[model samples]
Target: MKALSSYLTPVRACGAWLLMTLTGGGAACAQAPQEATQDRMVAKVNGAPILVSDLKQVTDAQTQGIRYQFADDPTKLANEMAAVKLNALDTLIDCQLLADEFYKIGGVMKPEFLEQDLTQIIQMGFRGDREAFMADLAQNGLALEKFRELRERILIMNVMRARIAGTVEVTEESLQEHYEKNLRRWSGPGKVKLHTVTISKKTADARSVADSLHTKLADGGDFEEIARKSSADSHATRGGEWNWLDPTDLTGTVSEVVLATKQGEISEVIEQLDAFIIVRVDDRQEGDPKPFESVKNEVTKSLMDEVSKGRIAERMIHLRAAADIQRMGAD
Candidate 1:
């Protein structure tokens, strides 16, 4: 029996089987006579039957996270499960409608391509062991031929999406508009690369030392060299240089002096709580708004996503309206 490869990528194939493995498919594989009679329809699209088992498969995959989240609350779990099942059923109905439309609208995909993709998926999912792959199918109660039909239908839906939603392109205007609308996201805070010279209050002439250092800076002394020789701060070993400091990270006289001082210039002696110090802005960068060229590709992709979402919703509505769709039972 041929496996349906078109609907599943190598990654998605593993994901499907992983979910099946976690949920355990023994019940589906061992249906009793009474269980077979109990099987019921959940939905129909253009007379194509969607069974409860179909809804169960989709909802089972979706509810894994929810189950983990509400494991302790049976009431919440039941409510959430009902919502998940309803949403999954609606999705399956739309998928069927789109698939039917895809064939009607002349979509075509070669079987050879699907077969090749399927081999890759199987190799990835079961380490290229055909027996393991088949065993998994048996455990999941999925016949090879039935799985192929399901995959073909899913592939048709994908083709419909490519024609409708995937064709959308983001315009330059839209990209620019998105960039402008979200300026803060692209802008960074102002930062300063500062170097300092300090004199400890414990030093008998701390004020005199600070004053002399300020004068040396004014007289074209090398700030780093002078700081290394005389500064008494934590950063003295690194020529009293402080890495880029954000505005909010500084306070008191240091903040006032640093903000007021021009880049590449030194401040006059300023008294701190227990020391006299001087600061110099080694390098400062004003937070400039990100240029259009820098974020154009990202903005374009974001705009395209918005357009694609709208396109899919619009196409689904059009397809559902044009097709004969009926929902039976709980959703």
Candidate 2:
């Protein structure tokens, strides 16, 4: 019976489980009712009553899957479920308002696209098996027509969001600002591609063997072949290739030795408890921010995302302000 605030963002459509007090305490509200059951009103957007059945579909879609996570805490689990249902209810109300505005503003979608989308969903989600998809609906007690209605509404909401996003443009200044602030993301820490050959301490004169391997590597001998024949390390089979590794992941003497080595150069013999290691730096990269012009397109797209989210949120706020939304259970 709680009246939801218009400022709330739309409930995310994923996840599942619930506690909202409503009619038919246990039996009638035990599970989402089948489509044939009489529609019970729970809210009204304008004069169109949002039915309890509609709330149930949203609730079930968002709740039932996560029920087992809170198996040990019944009271907390119920509260969590109620919160999810409440969120879904609010989102339903907002969706109705947005759908009205969308159609009123001449938003149009082709019928064929809807069918194509439904087909894709069934194919991708149910291995192209229509009956399996239908069985899922039957298990949830949902009718196909009703399910289609929800999908259509979701499609309409997407159209509305797209319209708002279309009006958003990323400015040059915004892109530069974003790039400067998130430089760490674009410019990663220094990394190295390395290959190693090792001789275990258990071997006779391990240092001498390590030196011999290092000389072969320095003389353009195949590092992989040398590692496969003589190295005692776990990764010897792969020619001791560690691929690209962050310098931070290397510890103590290993870190010091690798960081000081130049690309295409071999490190001096490093003595460890288990083996004598000789590493070759196949390649290295410095942690420097990429030039602005080099990453301009990517930065622009990221800025557009930020702009679009802001625009959609603002649009929703304006839409809610001009609409009438009523929850049936509010005293």
The C-alpha lDDT values of all candidates are 0.66, 0.68
lDDT of 1 by residue, 51-71 (tens): 776666545545665666666
Which predicted model would earn the best TM-score? 2
The candidate 1 region of ten consecutive residues with least summed lDDT is 19-28
Off by over 4 Å in 2: 1-38, 65-83, 108-111, 182-299, 329-331
Residues forming the 10-long window of minimal summed lDDT in candidate 2: 1-10
Per-residue error (Å), model 1, residue 54? 1.7
Model 1 lDDT vs. the true structure?
Answer: 0.66
What are the TM-scores, per candidate, against the unseen true structure? 0.50, 0.51
Model 1, C-alpha of 108: deviation from truth (Å): 3.7
Q: Write the per-residue lDDT of candidate 2 for residues 128-231, one digit (tens) a residue.
A: 88888888777666677676667666656665676666765667888899999888657755889998888998999877888888888889899899989998
